[model samples]
Target: METFDETDRRILSVLQREADIALEELGARVGLSRNACWRRVRALETRGVITGRVALLDPAKLGFGLMVFIQVHAARHDAEWLEKFGRAVREMPEILGVYRMTGDLDYLIRARVADVADYDKLYQRLIRKVELNDVSASFVMEELKDALALPL
Candidate 1:
């Protein structure tokens, strides 16, 4: 792990919240000169501490109002089955995250859709691409908290 002083933590915290903030402004917030701040940010990137910045979008605003968690039970546990499933999910735009899991479920998929009809269409498309022993879905009624920021 990379060692971080208080200044590094401050810079990371500010960047996590406001990635596009001007370098001068960011320096002011973190008590450093612009050049120094830039150097540290570059170091963080080089060291793989800071990955990449992205714009977070709202699913509702984009006409995808339904969020579903899908529990998938694979028909086969062979390498070929796993490969096909991975490729199919990678090509699917609606799938936000896919996880290999323990317990009763083989995999878990997080996805967004317009409605139940849309979700059904996604289900049809998915099944046509890969075989599954069983599948179940749970719709999110309310999202109390959703976050991407990791603690520094």
Candidate 2:
């Protein structure tokens, strides 16, 4: 595991929220020279601490206003079933996140669509790809807090 000092934490915290901030600006915020900041960021990237940066877009503006969390029970608890499920989800662009779970649920999927009709199409496409024992979905009424930044 990589150990982080106070300055490293500050740098990471700032980067997490604003990846596009100028190196000099970031250095100013974190109390370091621009070159020093660049060196630290390089080291962090080299150590696999800083991953690729991306723009977080508004789903509503993109016509993907509805968010749904899907609970799935696998047809079979086997490698074949897992591979098929993984492939199906990976191929579907609307599927944002898929997680193998513990307890009653076999897997959890988070996705975005236009509305009920759009979600139905996504469901139809998913079922056609792989067999599922059970599936249920819950639509998000309001997003109180949606974040990608990890706490430093």
Which candidate ranks first by lDDT, i.e. highest? 2
lDDT of 2 at 148: 86
- Tens digit of lDDT per residue, candidate 2, span 4-40? 9998999999999999999999999999999999999
Q: Pick the TM-score winner.
A: 2
**28-122 in candidate 1: lDDT tens per residue?**
99899999999999999999999998878888999999999999999999999999999999999999999999998999999999999999999
Off by over 4 Å in 1: none
Candidate 2, after superposition: displacement of residue 72 in Å? Answer: 0.2
For candidate 2, report its TM-score: 0.97
* Candidate 2: worst-modelled 10 consecutive residues by lDDT: 1-10
- State every prediction's TM-score relative to the real structure: 0.94, 0.97
